[model samples]
Target: MVVEQFLTYLQHEKRYSSHTIQSYKIDLTQFGDFILKTFELSLTEVKYVHVRDFMVTLMDHEVSANSVGRKLSTLRSFYKFLLRENIITASPMALVKAPKVPKKLPVFIEDTKLDLLLDSEELFDDSFPSVRDKLIIETLFGTGMRLAELLALKDADVNFYDSTIRVMGKRSKERIIPIGKGLAEQLKNYISLKTLQNFHNKTTGLIVTDKGADAYPGFIRGIVQRYLAFISTQDKKSPHVLRHSYATSLLNRGADLNAIKELLGHASLAATQVYTHNSVERLKTIYKQAHPKA
Candidate 1:
């Protein structure tokens, strides 16, 4: 019951996305099961030592540090909630520390490679599916929206005359992302094709499957991976990479950091600041190649 109450708080008060709330639920449930079985205690009764033992069990099972860290984070939030609600007199997670995850720079396809892929007329045919796929790629790179945000996009979200799209971001925050003329035209064409589909019960979501069903997560991921493979050899070809590419591209082109943060709908500037490292790396590479001093 406490878990359900915490989840309700997350959903209504915190406005966490459903997907995120689900993850939190899974994490809490896993911890609850662990504590119940191992320590003969419910979630609120677990102490710091019990949490540490759980961490040891996870490590013993060879779970990746990143995953173990996430589980710990979930416990931290749950315990915090319990404390706030007076369900617990003290917090056990106050003593726990998350593992330090390795810092890897965000990966992005070069702008030239992306341009080559998007501009190649032979790659995207005139058919509805083909055109629709192209628009999906364009929208991801053009707007820097997350996959969930893209899927949540509705027909009413686009303003053709204003060249803007309002996307629902993390915590149900809504922000308007400006679109380029080329992408706007592409969207218009895709909508025209979608309108001609024979499905009687059409979905209002902006992007859909060839069968006119609203696009799901796997469907969108497959589209991004399939298209990105032609241009990038990086192991990660997910939609988030396009989001990174969009941010890096803007930062490289001299867009202000705060502006990039707003466009990407980041909670803070620190998330947007990572793109600056990519730009600095580029400058270093250029200097190495062109400078006279050996």
Candidate 2:
């Protein structure tokens, strides 16, 4: 009952998405089960030792540090919530520390290859599906929006006259992303084609299936993967890769970090700073290849 209430708090007060709330629920439930089975105690009775023991148990099972870290974060949030509500006198998470997660530069498609893919006239056509597919790639690479943001996009969110698209981001935050004239034209054409088809169950969603249903995660992923496979050999090819590509492309071309943060709708400059690593690596390669004195 307490767990359900906490999840409701996450949903209504924290404004966490369904996916995030589900993950938090899973983490909390697993911890609850662990304590009930081993210590025979409820969540309210947990202590710092118990939290540490849970961490050890996770490691013993050979869970990745990244996964363990996320679980610990879930516990921290849960305990914090209990403390705030006076359900618990203190949080057990004060002494708990997350395992270090190795930093990996984000995977991105080279601009040249992406250009080749987008510019190839034979790759896309005027048909609704094809135009829609191309626009999917363009919107992702052009706006740096997340998959969830793209899924939530609606016709009303777009302002062709202003050359911007209003994107609803994490925690219900909203931001306007500028669109290129080319992309705006593409969006105009795609919407025109979609209206002409006039499917029986069409919605106001910006992107839709051939039958006019709102696009889901799998639908968007499949479309992105299918198109990316034609040009990119990278193992990771999703809408997120396009988002990374968008950020990297901007940073490489000297866009300010804070500006990129706002454009990407990142909550902080730290998140936006990762793209600088990509730029630095590229400069190192240039130095190695072109420097006369090695």
Candidate 3:
């Protein structure tokens, strides 16, 4: 009942995306089931100790710390709602600590390999689908746009003469990013081809797709995998890695961090700052190899 109410609150008040709301509902439902089994109490009767015990059981089952931490976060938010409604006088999860998650650097292909991947003429073909696929890869690597942003692009969002594309990022915030000359030209050619093929549907905004339909997440992932399978050995070769590669390349070439942050539509410089670590490590490697000291 609590989770049902929470789901409604998230949909109506929070305005979370349907996918996000569904994920929250599943997570909370699992937690509710677990708590019910452990304590044999109704949702209204759950106490702090029961929550803590649930966490212990999760640990006993060897759930990853991150998983436990996320579940705790969901529970905390749920209980916060209860507290606000005066359903509970005290918060049980208020004192609960979240598991520490280690910061992992974004993985990216080297510039040489990226160039090879992008420049492989064999990858490009004269067909509409092939051109569209190539342009999608080019745009993602060119602008570091998130997969969702790329999939949401419209023909109107691109300006070939200005060499820029407007992207709607997280939270529906819009930002315009300049495209490189290479990618700009590629986009122009792709657009011209799209016009010739009559692929642009009036109602759809997606730039690349089969039969004018919008690309779902699975289609995007498959595209990335197919293109990357040739050039990357990295296990995580998704469109996000193309984003990482773009940011890393920009930082390596002396682009300002703040500028990159804005270009990538990151909310804060801190999120953009991680790429600097990758740059620093590269510099250290060069220093060690070039230095005379043994």
Q: For candidate 1, what is the TM-score?
A: 0.97
lDDT, candidate 1, at 21: 95
Q: What does the lDDT come to for candidate 3? A: 0.83
TM-score of each: 0.97, 0.97, 0.90
Error of 2 at 77 (Å): 0.9
Better of 1 and 3 by TM-score: 1
Candidate 1 wrong stretches, greater than 4 Å:
198-200
Q: For residues 156-267, could you state the per-residue lDDT of candidate 2 as single tens digits?
A: 8999999999999999999999999999998899888988989424698999999999999999999999999998888999999999999999999999999999999999
Task: List lDDT for all candidates, in order.
Answer: 0.91, 0.93, 0.83
Clash counts per candidate, in order, are 0, 0, 0
- lDDT string for model 3 (1-294, tens) is 667888788778767667767777777788778877877777667777888788888889999888888888878888888888888888888778877777889999888987887778798777888877888778888899998888788878988778889898875678999988988777778777777767675334646567766677888889888998899877998999999999999999999999999999999999999999999999999999999981
**lDDT value, residue 291 of candidate 3:** 92
Which residue window of length 10 is worst by lDDT in model 1? 193-202
lDDT of 2 at 9: 96
Tens digit of lDDT per residue, candidate 1, span 1-294? 999999999999998988989999999898899989887898878999999999999999999999999888888888899999999999998878887788779999889999999998889999998998899899999999999999999988999989999999998888999999999999888888788785325778998998999899999999989989898888999999999999999999999999999999999999888889899999999999999982
Better of 1 and 2 by lDDT: 2
